[model samples]
Target: MESMTETEQRATRDQRARFEALARVVTEPLHRYLLRRAEPDQVDDVLSETLLVLWRRIEDVPGLEASGYVSGPAPDPDAVLPWCYGVARGCLANARRADRRRRSLLERLTWTVAGAARETGDADHTALHAALAQLRALDREVVLLWAYEELTPSRIAEVTGLSANAVSIRLHRAKKKLAAQLERKTGPHPGHETDEGQGTATGNGNGRSSR
Candidate 1:
């Protein structure tokens, strides 16, 4: 490969210096945000991607962006960097995009699993599962993405092949339906027994009938 010209070398050094400084301020927060979006186990992968972006586009990284400071003897550059939130947010969006394509087929699978059944005595689990069984397909999928799979809306869209806005809307509606289900579960109707907001009883782990 051709050696970098002196001009390119100087430019690279300056850019590296700026990015070092940016990393000092953002290291902790960036890692924490990634941990939340992905997991502690995946933090390194996400962080690597974030830093790679910073390195590749150091020139594009304005003093106010994610460029690092010159390290060691290089005096702390008295320059304002881009809001760390912006950097982390962009990184998160990129990470989410990367997850989308891989999850496409799996996300297309049927929402309901044959194994999910009502639990006895655990009123909370029973109530929640009952509500899930009552939700519309799209809405239920969004709720499971967040609650069960621990995914953000962007990730959910990648799986569901829906837009982020649409995923958010469906999630909201799903949660509301879940809440309404719980409400009706306690609501008085003939043949339906109210637990009086106490603990409702079920039998065989699947029956809606009171014990």
Candidate 2:
């Protein structure tokens, strides 16, 4: 292998540092987000897919300051984390689609095998799932991103390709709609009321927003 000059070595070190910083910031939260939405067994696989994309596009990971603080005027997390969520969103979607295809193939090949894979039921869980299913895709995403993932509307805007104001409005409306549906189905659980007028920013542990 060719020896790296001093400058080349420094540049390589900086790149690795930036990638590690992003991984440190995103790994746990990203995995949790995937876990909340994905089938339990596929969460790790989907998380691996998300991280693989991150590794492949390390140079393109945004918000890394040259000094490695990964911060700017607004905050490094705001810039970078949303972008990471966007990547994860796509990876999760692809994984789910592939899973469906695989299940379909299995069922076609052997009904007994496929029947054994059926998911177990819970009434509360089923009600929530049904309510969520009733929502339009965008509305469902806004609700899940806010309530389940604890993402702020601005961050969700980055992931869903909506304006911040749009995300806020959609999230607000979706919450009301979901609340109503759930109430009608199974009555309110404790603490079921939506927290209205919450600010658009609820900073995650790292103060990152979704992109």
Candidate 3:
């Protein structure tokens, strides 16, 4: 195993410093990415744009990216992230725009397929909706992107500002959490098939909080 060279070490430190600038000084509540999306479909769009912004402006950094020359207008100081939450926010806004052009009601990201064993009753759906509301924004985004939008990890990488590896890890964690949450609420999930929209999420017909 070779150790990092001097230049590489410095580069690593510099990268960390720059990331910190975006996360700490630039954006507030950096973790609060997905909740900002009003609708589930909005999450996919936002994640896509956010990743694009990160890749494009990464060399310059967001606010500091333009600090060297003041000739052009900057994206604004407040809009930064570990990579610039601006990317995330921008993605969200773009997703919102795209969603407007099409149906706004479909859960683009967090889709649920109802199992035959589980009745198509509104009660099952109602409980599922309530449980979904309880998830953190990050978890929700992961669930939607993987379960609903059906985007691949590389594609998800474009939205989340994370490498595909990171996206996979996050998604796995999100699923585990979601399953546990569902189990706790409904005893266990009933099986279901969700193709397109309007399917049932199965559970033991257990009650859930109306959060």
Best by lDDT: 2
Per candidate, the number of residue pairs that clash is 15, 5, 18
Model 3 agreement with the true structure over 154-202: per-residue lDDT tens digits? 8888987779998888777765555555455554343333322435333
Give lDDT per model, in order: 0.59, 0.67, 0.52
Tens-digit lDDT track of model 2 for 1-211:
6556977887777666677777887888898888788888778888898988987787777775655434423226677888899999999899877655444432321232222212212212455567668999998888667654557888999999999999988866765665566556654344443334544334354534434
- Model 3 stretches with alpha carbons more than 4 Å out: 1-123, 188-211
- Ten-residue segment with the worst summed lDDT in candidate 1? 112-121
By lDDT, the candidates rank as: 2, 1, 3
| Poorest 10 consecutive residues by lDDT, candidate 2 | 115-124
TM-score of each: 0.39, 0.45, 0.32
Which of candidates 2 and 3 reaches a greater lDDT?
2
Q: How far is candidate 3 from the true structure (C-alpha RMSD, Å)?
A: 15.0
